[model samples]
Target: MTEVLQDLAEYIEQKRSDCVISWGFTNGELNISVAPSNITSFVEFLRSDSRCKFSTLVDITGVDYPDRTKRFDVVYHLLSMYQNHRIRLKVSIRESEAIHSIVSVHPSANWFEREVFDMFGILFRDHPDLRRILTDYGFQGFPLRKDFPTTGYNEVRYDEVQKKVVYEPVSLTQEYRQFDFMSPWEGAEYIISDDEAEGSKLMDGSKGFKDTLTSEQKIRNFNINFGPQHPAAHGVLRLVLELDGEIVERCDPHIGLLHRGTEKLMESRTYLQNLPYFDRLDYVAPMNQEHAWCLAIEKLTKVNVPRRASLIRVLYSEIGRILNHLLNVTTQAMDVGALTPPLWGFEEREKLMVFYERACGARLHAAYFRPGGVHQDLPDDLLKDIANWAEEFPAVLQDIDELLTENRIFKQRNVDIGIVSEDDIQKFGFSGVMVRGSGLAWDLRRAQPYECYDEFDFKVPIGKNGDCYDRYLVRMEEMRQSLSIIKQAIQKLLDEPGDILARGKITPPKRAEMKGSMEALIHHFKLYTEGFHVPEGEIYACVEAPKGEFGVYLVSDGSNKPYRAKLRAPGYLHLQAMDHMASGHQLADVAAIIGTMDIVFGEIDR
Candidate 1:
């Protein structure tokens, strides 16, 4: 591994010449810092070079440093499926300068670049149709910038006179007692000025919710809003479709309706407080999201978890995967016409939800995972329930197979529909079942094992075709594999019964210890009030989430809170392929395509 990274560093430096500013290996990954001018050519080399086949664009985001002259640092993460290697490229650019867009090279940078533009106000030159993706129309300043206020410049309220929601200058109804006879909402005079509001349009390139075609051209292609509120969209996704008769000519997805500023909120809170925020990302599989965050923080802090905790994490993660897959398959079947799958699927999901509630107090937003380990150990009876469920799940799965596996109506609607190719998977950065359904045996658990995954024996399912039916088959097979893993994990838990959390300053004292000992009480207070600080560095940790590769890119500045927290949600990337996948197919197939992709807008719009 070291030799390969050394070779890659030497090869890049030797080929790129002065473009390579610096390079090094950290956390078993290669990082290359380059000039902004050479980013396009460098990424192309990484994609095409035989020695470095970093074909997959995992994620692209920006970090804002208001103190530096080059205030914005654009970071691009790439993965090599052939070699099982990863690399990160960073380029520091001034706020005034524009970084070259890699859309011409990767094509998947279409929405990622727009997100960076929307969040950090960084411009990407030559980006086709660059617009605000995760923000409202005519939004003010960049929300992710360091100088931006947490409460924002304006707040929306329903005006009694206007009879509609209107944006007004932010005002505080009551001040917190912590302030020294001053309100947190003070000094808003500067932000509420007319100049800044007017200057906000400097970056507004989109035609604000208007007609794209002239009256004469409208006859050929007309536009319709599919939903920010449509039943078929699954969530709060709003797709603007330009159609000719029954065929969709163009589809533009307008998300961010559920924008909660999760990343910025993570930066404001301590490390422990950020755990619950991830659960709200993909609410269906909250544990999977929290697992990625825990891995990233543990990697940076170099915390070692106990064997028991590892087994518990593996167990719940698999259960969460099955839970998520059940919902996807049943909902996909329901969208296509069959309704029985949902009834059977939700019944099983309720059982899993009970397991979640047994482990953690909450079912949907279970903040069970922590940096060192889990929030607490599982109950004694929970294992018995899971073991019994694993035994009976096969019969339930068989019922689903009998209903939809060969049903004529289900096959007619799904077979040979919304077909995606291997190239499509590579270009659009598809993972999970989307890539596996296309014959790519790339499960991260096997490819790059984490926690106790390497010790467990399991199979990675693959499909021959990349159609909707193939994707469904892949997910169903994956759930069976998950059940196998869960059984193994349950046995391991019984074999190894010990401490769940690692012994360190990071973990809080036990409730019994805190009640009796004064030292333990102080330790608990300090741990919660000022969270454990991590070493100054950056790391990108990922897990094979049910939807796809859910990753957390964290940078710590030796501070309690994360310097910059960016979530690389697979749903966001998968949703980008909707227009391409649904272009030629009839408009009715859009729902089936969306169902197969399994996008939860909570993660996509985050």
Candidate 2:
């Protein structure tokens, strides 16, 4: 690790020829954070420098710190495709200013930078067509900043004449948004009540409301709202597209309509309490989401899961991956006018969900994973069932291939639609099938092995065209790979029979005597009421989820609840590439492009 960092420092020094601000590693990966002014040169050097040919931009996200000297920090994660090394670049800027945009270096940074600008109010200098990418147009203030009110600045009224919604600024004299770090119910003070706003209206008539923009005024160049309702969109995501005929001049995705402020909510709940919320983040694959969070907490607390538990986690996670990818591909096919594939995909997925039910006792929102270990051990019958399904899944795959792989209409509609190049994948810091479809052999499970993935022998599939068809083919192949992993995991489980839950802090009392013994009852009550405390530290845990590298970066300050929890969702990155993919394509291909990206709005909105 020291040698790797030393080599990285030398690489950064050589690349930055002019000024190398700082270079180091955090949480085991190399990081070279440069000044805002030196960003372009630094990126160019990193891209061209043979030693550190960082060919892919993994992610670009903004962090707000109103109390700090540097008000905001824009972070970029870069990956070296050849070396299989990762680096993080952080550029700090004051609230009053904007930093130079890296979109020119990586076009996928375009939407990501726009998202920063939209949520945190960090301006990206020279960002071509920088606008609100997540929030609605005419949004009053940056939502992610510490000072920004959780409920937003004011109430918005629809202007019939203008055909748009307008925001009316309210008084800054009101109390700050109160967030309780103890429990979700205790955080009621932070919530905005309709009665309070209405009472304020009675006092001043116009004190709380302000007109920002009307629909007619906001509309330009063939603008249309895709959905806060359209089924083609996976969830309640609304996209306002500005088109010049069939060409998308500007594409702005309005998220947060389904905003439950999940991170904020999690910060108020105990580590155990937060597990259920992960299920909500990516409802389609709750197991993957829960596993990512569990891994993050487990890493921070230095808890070693038992061999049996690790194998069970892997088995469940792989099943979830297959289920998620199947649904995504099937739905995407349906969106592109191929209806039969979705039914075929769902049928297989339902079978997997049945297995999940046998294992976790729940299908969609399985709170199966817990810190230190899992909630319970897999039953012998369930194990046999999963093994049977694993054996039979290949036949189902062959049937799916026969149905869609050679179908002329499916091929014609998806072949060249939504072509995301290797450059775009790198720029957007895309992962999973999106990156694989672009020909990059980067997978978190392989690149940074977690759980018992290193023990499993499986292949990471890659695509050539970076098109929708490639994404479909890659996911189809991935399902088979996942089945192979599951089979291996089942074998391991049979070989290792032991306690599924670790015997230490945070372990639940045995169920056998809870009802009869007062001591066990009291223990259970204490565990649920107070929750286990974690050491003061932060850790970022990631897994190769079906959508992409679903990561949970958690900060724990020796509290029952988290200090802060951020989900590094891959769907957000894929959504950012929508414009680039659908720019010149026909309007009808928009659905095909969206389908190909396989974005679940739950992840995107969260």
Candidate 3:
């Protein structure tokens, strides 16, 4: 691993010596530090270079160091699908300095750069349309900064007089009280009710009611708020749609309503404590997200996961894929007025959630997948049940297919509503069904080959037309492929029976052993209390989550808590292209587009 990185490092330095200043490998992942001024040229070189084709700009983030001369470290993570390598590029700049934007190199970096600007207050020069991407419009301080207060700058409230939401300084010390020194309607030009008139002759021409009417109202195309509350929104996803009668002209997506500051929050929490947060991101298909973070930490520490544990991870990840797809497929059916699919799909979904409960005790936010392995191994009985469930699952899928695949209404609604071409897919950083629906035979499970996925035989489902229907078909087929992987994983789990965790200080000692031995007790004490310290380095690990590619970029700084943690949510990127997808389509198609995008707020709000 070191030797290959050395060759690549040598190649990059030799080829672009003016840009490359220094480079190193941390746990086999290459990290290159370059001059901020040459970022555009350097990134373009990476995308175009034969030996160093880091085509996919996976994520862009900034790490804040309060005391340093260069207070911000703008980091870029890239992946080479063709070369099969990942690299991190770092550029340090002062708080006031703006770095050159790489949007010209990778258009995927648009939202990511805006997010960086929003979170860290880091500026990007020449970004096409840079603004606050995640935070509210009038958001105060950069929430992710080290110095920003947890309580936040202002208390938000609706000002009735102004007829708008306003931000005011929070009075934390005072007990919550409203001091109404003046009447709410003191200055308003409205006639008080007869009860408040305080006069007997109130009806006798005492200026009872003032009529304020105007005929100057002009009509035009309207800007509509689709949802911060509507059902088809999936969760608090609000789109400000500019409409020309029934057709959509522009869609401005306003996110961060549900933002808990996952990245900023992770910086203060321990590795173990932070694992549950990933589950919270993609709530439906949680384990797949946990799998990504687990792989990241494991890669940073260079820990080996046990074969049995790897199989269990694979099995559940496939389950998550089905779980997410079922909800999306059914709800997408519901979006088009067909209510039967969700009812039919969720019946199969409940059984899968039962499997989750059996494995981790929590059905939804199952923080089961740890760094070295899963929290515990699945029992033989559960495995048998899964094997049995796998056989029955196909009938449910086929029944759903009969309902929607050929149904005229469903077909008409989704057939060409949200057509995404291959160019748009690559340009917008689409993944999962978004990528596959565009006819790209690219699945991270196949291209990246994480865990034991390569050993399993499964087909990658690709779509031809790149429309909503094609995306649906890809997901339906992917669910079947997931079942195949799950079945194969069950067999592998039976064959490779061994320790469910890595054998080292990383994995906690068994409870039984802790009671018997002093060394075991010490191991348990340190692990539970302090948590293990990861090696001081940075790694961006991703899993082909059901939605798309959900990634975690971790900067350890050799601490119990991460120095910086940035989540690359595929939904965040996919949703950014909502305007691209919805323009020229009707208002009704908005629901279909959002549904087929398979958006869940858990990740986007982060």
TM-score per candidate, in order? 0.89, 0.82, 0.87
Candidate 1 lDDT, tens digit per residue, 423-492? 8887999999999998899999999999989998999988888999999999999999999999999988
The 10-residue segment with the lowest total lDDT in model 1: 173-182
Cα lDDT of candidate 2 equals: 0.78
Minimal lDDT window, size 10, model 3: 173-182
- Write one digit per residue (lDDT tens) for candidate 3, span 1-606: 578878999999999999998998766678899999999999999988888877777788889888899999999888775677778899999989999999998888888898888888888999998888676544656777777745554768899999999988875432222333344456545566777554424323333443357544333455668888999899998888877778999998888888887887888788988999988898989898899889988999999998899989999999999999999999989988998888988888999999999999998989999989989988899999999999998999989998889999889999888899867875677878898998888889998888988999999999999999999999999999999999999988877688888967678987788789999889888887898898898777888999998888888899888988888888887898899999999999999999989988889888
Model 2 Cα shift for residue 68 (angstroms): 3.5
- Against the true structure, candidate 2 reaches a TM-score of 0.82
- Ordered by lDDT, highest first, the candidates read 1, 3, 2
Compared with the true structure, model 3 gives a TM-score of: 0.87
**Candidate 2 Cα misplacement greater than 4 A, ranges:** 10-25, 31-33, 64-67, 92-94, 136-138, 147-224, 240-252, 509-526
Which candidate number has the best TM-score?
1
Question: What C-alpha RMSD separates each model from the true structure?
Answer: 8.8, 11.3, 9.7
Distance (Å) between predicted and true CA of 141, model 1?
1.0
Cα-based lDDT at residue 298, candidate 1 = 90
**Native-to-model Cα distance after best TM-score fit, residue 589 in candidate 2, in Å:** 1.9
